[model samples]
Target: MINSIKTPNRLVNEKSPYLLQHAYNPVDWWPWCEEAFAEARQENKPIFLSIGYSTCHWCHVMGRESFEDQGVAGILNRSFVSVKVDREERPDVDAVYMAICQALTGQGGWPLTLLLDTKKRPFYAATYLPKNSRYGMTGLTELLLKVSELWKTSRNRLLESGEQIVEAMREQDRTGYVQEPEKNLLYEAFSAFAHSYDSRFGGFGEAPKFPAAHNLLFLLRYAKEENPAASEMVLHTLDGMYRGGLFDHIGGGFSRYSSDEKWLVPHFEKTLYDNALLVMAYLDAYTQTKEPLYRHIVRKTLDYASRELTAPEGGFYCGQDADSDGEEGKYYLFIRQEILDILGENRGRRFCEWFGITEQGNFEGKNILNLVENANYREINPTMEHCCEKLLCYRARRTFLHKDDKCLTSWNALMITAYVKAYLILEENQYLDTAQKAERFLEEKLSRDDKLFVRWREGVSAGYGKLEDYAFVVWAELMLYQAIFDIRYLKKAVRFADTMCDRFFDDTEGGFYLYARDDERLILRPKETYDGAMPSGNSIAAYVLGKLFKITGEEKWRERSQKQLRYLAGSSGRYPAGHGFAMQAFMDALNPSQELIALSPEQEDLRKLRKLVAAKPNLTVVVKSPENGQELAELSPYTKEYPVTAGHPQFYLCSGNSCAASVDTLQALKW
Candidate 1:
């Protein structure tokens, strides 16, 4: 019995919250490192690799059912070298193995279970399993025993399988061919999205709907450039998500996703990236339609991020757990009686009516507040706002919500971009300040010697910057440069982009690798193009490179962007909807893009031009004053040619290879 030894395992020393959660397990668990693999080799035992995040509900479930059980732990301790990984902390490891799991099982998810040989190549892979066999599913205990028996009897066969999986993965990576993206690919992607469009519920497909904000972003571009009809789908999905329980009407953010198509019941985890991307989507919607509702949602979601997920050092935290007090959604779920007791009869009844709160309840005899049934809920009222504030306060007192305080550079960069977009669109000064502050936090904490790290928690930063981190930080810096017209941000962006190319770019294959070349080498290097929940690193790299090429007119950047786009074109051709962000990048590559250089000695004129540029999705702007003209020139050498007029601002509009005549007035510059 493993539980007989009360001492903690190796995971007790790990900084990751997910690893720390398993520190007290009866089974001895090792954090992913060289020592664990060395031990596996020495002991001649197969490695049991488990990958999951802290907020994942099923990760918690499996931990409770198997890892914590003495009998199961005994079996694992005897036969295998158990290693745990927080997928968020080490996405590079997760990506390589998750691909293996999917290739082997045709599916992938959290609480990933795998049996690997001493070399770390997976021979067996599956997602969740119980302690004992039930419901036609093999249990963890039985599986572990079987694998142990196989390791002793058929060791060669197991090693051969591992070798085959690795070779096959390498072959699959090599099989990708570069194809020139055609204009028709955009239409093909649009058609795929239209096919899966959930006409009634606002998202695509069936149950468990994710707020794929990148998909909406791609559709927005399509609507603007191609068909006006595409916009309705975006609007409907945004509205549907807002009205559903997927959105936290009382507390202000969105949950991870919904369990049903109508968006009624959510999994209740509130992630920083989801909120950040959703904010961008809503802000773009507001800009497109001038819809006040979209604006409201953007503000509320940002406010929620600031209030709940933000660290005092100005970096955003990872997410909040879906479970509280060992029960899923306990902190979020509300009883009708509790609502009535908190708000009194009249106000409570009205509040309950507006939000779909009923005595019968929608989830496990508790209510998840939503406005799906109420059409007039959009009407602003002081009483409803006040009631929500009171309920928020009361909910805090009732139970505790677990917050994942680790700040990831990629997710924080995404929020920084969201805040910048909000500031530009809403003309909010605080949003700009917030964006700049968070960028400063990243530069100070998560970066070392000009190299970005993946995560920071409790004064310790770990993991070399991955493709997502570098791409997103470049994106954030570019956005900040546009927001404040600061040469420093643009210069930093250029430097980081250069470093990113040196470290992660695959010269022969054409896409960025998930992990840098200098970082730890896993079983196989992965280049992910499929956008799941968030935009893939290659997609963002393609996007920022295109923007860099346009703004700076750097031939290197243009070549890199074109190469990345061609690589993506090959992957996205078969299933374009899945590569929504890459498709958006391709759209940018195909469309007529304009870069506007606004130069003025007067600050007011430059300020007005900033707003104008923000409204035009196709336009990239760089503002220059006589004071910082030299600095601007260093970042964008072409900008040095555009002279700053003393009183009137000069605008140089460049599209394709041609430059328009300088126009002093904003109205004279044709969009």
Candidate 2:
């Protein structure tokens, strides 16, 4: 049956791991193109737009449950023009539809399903419906029948709702936007978080805890600037997660999200974004406390990335599937007897005790460790080192981990920043080298025609770079510059930033648009700024501009950054908690930041620069080429006075209005 349906899809020729994933689906699905929409109109059939990415756990679930069923596929093909969209490659379409779905259903998530009129107006929307009616939600068949009935009998009703939804989105987009001034917005966000703080468990609110690593980072920034309680909220959550089953104690990375509030039991899905963001949060936590365990998490997460997710060429994969053998959590969840079988009697008992695995079990007679429950027992008998070794050995046996081998540029950029920052703080060269290798992997596979593509699976690069790709990579470039004084990198970054300004920048509006005008058409061209689960492109654009201004001594960059703040000023108060990550970018906008330009070749300057950078709280440093190093010399000119013994190190410290004295020698570099 699947073989019959594979005949008409353009996905037959595509290389994306996600596209290939649906290649065998019995539904005659069409990839997003004018062709599918044209066919829908010609056939006078409604369109079924199924938007999802390769890594979404529920996406996989819906695919297996609905898409793979021959009977459901037949229904999908006959009743509607089924169109599949990889949200990662086409986020613009995803955003518009996701917004409409949330508007119609009052909730939205992946495996997004929308039944549209032949005219391409959404009439009905739902996410993750079962093939047959089982759960409280309606069945896919009944949904198709109902929508078809409406399309034939009450077309005006569909059109009216569609028009209303779009108009509502436009009005909201225009209103509730205001400019951020200081930590008030951030403090307000923290104040909101303070209300939701789980004093016992650490993360905000109750059950289904997402790592919200960026939120925690925002908390730390808040802690540093506005309130101690804010930072405490982050650290306590980190402690809870680390101690919880949310963290795979043996494996280095985090699962998708916890099933319950305590972070003890997870949905058992490991994702690239979760791990990447968690790595960033843990690294930041280590920066604050220098606690050995947090440092261990930093290395462990990286190690996990290196071992499972890393492509042979060096870039990381998109994510790992939560389901295997048609059973969710089967690959990750373990029975008590199996643990003893692999690890033997003595080692197994200790492992079971450490992981809190018992015969009665935590989940269906299986154990998922809410690990640090018996902290006293662990502390007195075994050191953390002993526990780590045993757990690590036990975790190594899970060989069925499903890694989504599609390398994504935006996600990789985040990883690069995390790795670069970790190496900077930890003084580990391996992490730095791995960061460089990942960057090189992106260039080799994802960049062509000076335009970066989004996904790299097999050998093909798919889609033009999204705003996230440009913004995060620009941020990563600056971080790379800070870690190693690469002049070429600065030049390259300037060129990319300039390209971004030309292609995606909104000259009329202050903020950067989500995609270039040439990008695939969607209903709306929204300029996103507030951070959600992921960082917003507009916020990141503002972030880059602020950092670039400090680096190049350009006033225009500063002006642009300020304008973005103005655009995002409204509605920021309403969802300040969700906007925590972007608030860090907002903090950059308000601060008179200095780009601590280091003047030297890449080698010696890197060594000298690390000392200048290490252990400095709240200092944002940018390394510049030795040649233009003097251009910023007016900022911190004291570096030129004292010649160093080994290799010359010149530092230029420029803030908002004035330049501090530059220092060259280690002695002169004293703060």
Candidate 3:
């Protein structure tokens, strides 16, 4: 009987560590599958869906309290068809439930619990309920009983509510913003951030400081526009954050957020999405400024993901849990005694003092792995290349924390973009190779026809891919193409972009929907434009659509891109955060400013041509090799084609997409 039960709801372990975590759960949970829904219908019971990613602290808490509790298990097994879902794996399922939970609770978080009718329509949802009910809310047992009772007594009401929500979830607005965002709006947003900026702290808001990298990205662009200090403010905050506790000095990654505003304390969970986006931001900063510290963080963060979060199958994992053994931040937190023991009193004291690891400790008598406690690695600036190699090794010696190994396409795509960008900036060929390998793994492994699956843990693919999967993957493919000029990546991206335009793009409303038409239903399809901890799909779509137009020169793509940007432009003033998409979109909207520089076989010619362009401010230059480099060369009217007459040096100047006539020397193009 036990073997038979396991076979019906069994998850085929593929690559995710998170799904495997539930492989042995007694509740007879199945990954998102038709059989499970069939079972629910056959049993004539509501579906008990638990959605969470691996690194979620609340997810871990809820699992220990409820899933691990045999009493709770008994109740779940007897009344409902229980299912375990990693939100990262099956974002469609999570997205639907999250919408319901947020609408009902006014907020939503991990460890999402929901009751859906046999048709997979969610009638009720909540996040992280305690087992025994101590925090003013009802206990899990009581809530379960009440929901079950409601299902039994008022099935009609549940159907009505679920149907209405499903309809609402399908609706999308197709009208673009009335006009493009004016300069005043950008100025006003920057001014607001400055006024609210925390002088002592790195972030803009109070406690639970999210790394607001999106806002800072806007700030950097704004600063480059006119206000020099505006850019400085962003850099200053980033510097503080890098030095603060939010960055895991020893582990080579960042925590979810700083518990305090000053960036001295963190919530301690390292999310793959957060790290990936942060690395992108940091890499951008490093590219423009050549800041060593920013580059260090980027490398370290990438190293951490590659070492710890990567699956053997070449895909990236979701995250690492924030807590361990019921104590918050236990696996990561360190005592002063341990530090002293690890590196002796002198270096340990210095490390503690440098990273703010005092005798009293920063969090519950244990020091979070922050930079403040370390010796001033920045100021000292010894031969240590960001202290990542040694620290990551040392941190490994301790209890390796539990990792969430679910591979979400969106998150993997983001990481892919980061790796591609880092490869471009650092000229590290390995990063690019790794990026392509991971992309291949997703394409060959997780994709089913045109529809993409969100999470793959332990070799099992579960959950429907949402709009995020398309947006982020398109963005990643674009970067990958740019990193190596691959046509295949571009072609794949083009096909997916079309689907996004046809299916996910809101024709009546200018914004995009979070889920595809064929995906599961939730409270609302949720046209999310706000840039919260991460940039929203609507915003991402706008940016990606704009890029596709630039790459492919398709006017239809450009129009769609404009529509997406315009959609957000209407609210850009009120929601500056929404402008994350607008920022990248703005670049494409500009008059195509093109500059091409060609190099002869001579080194001096290359340097002179590079300096000529680099010396100019606000201009982006694209370089080409002399061998088979005619794509840009023949197109460039400014730069001479193949062999230079001088045979020593050559140069090209171009305007718009077209280049000026080729010049034999840099001096030929000079005034």
- RMSD to the true structure for each prediction, in A, is 1.8, 3.4, 4.8
lDDT of 3 at 667: 71
lDDT of 3 by residue, 1-671 (tens): 01335433364453445556666566677777788889999998888888876677777677778876778888888888988876666565666677667766788877888888888888778888899888697788887788788878988898888777666555523332446755665666777788777777566767877886877776776665547667777876787778777787776788888877778777788888889888877876775688788888888789889888898889997777776666667766778887777677787676666666767877888876556434454553542333334555666775667776667888899899889877867767789888998999889777877667777766678666788888888888777765554456766787778877777877765778778777765445667676656777777888788666644555788688777777777756565644664654554455344444455436555444334332332333434455535554433333333454334445556666666777765677743
Query: Residue by residue across 234-292, what tens digits does model 2's lDDT show?
Result: 88888888888777766668887888888887777777777888888887778778777
Cα lDDT for residue 32, candidate 3:
75
Query: Model 1, residue 316: what's the lDDT?
Result: 96
What does candidate 3 score on TM? Answer: 0.83
RMSD (CA, angstroms), candidate 1: 1.8
Top-lDDT candidate index: 1
Worst 10 residues of 3 by lDDT: 612-621
Off by more than 4 A, model 1: 1-6, 645-648
Q: Over all chains combined, what TM-score does candidate 1 have? A: 0.98
lDDT of each: 0.90, 0.75, 0.70
CA deviation > 4 Å runs, candidate 2: 1-10, 176-180, 376-399, 595-605, 611-618, 622-652, 662-664, 667-670
Specify the highest-TM-score model's number: 1
Off by over 4 Å in 3: 1-16, 41-43, 164-181, 188-192, 287-289, 311-314, 369-377, 380-394, 427-430, 436-465, 484-503, 506-510, 516-527, 571-574, 587-671
- TM-score of model number 2: 0.91
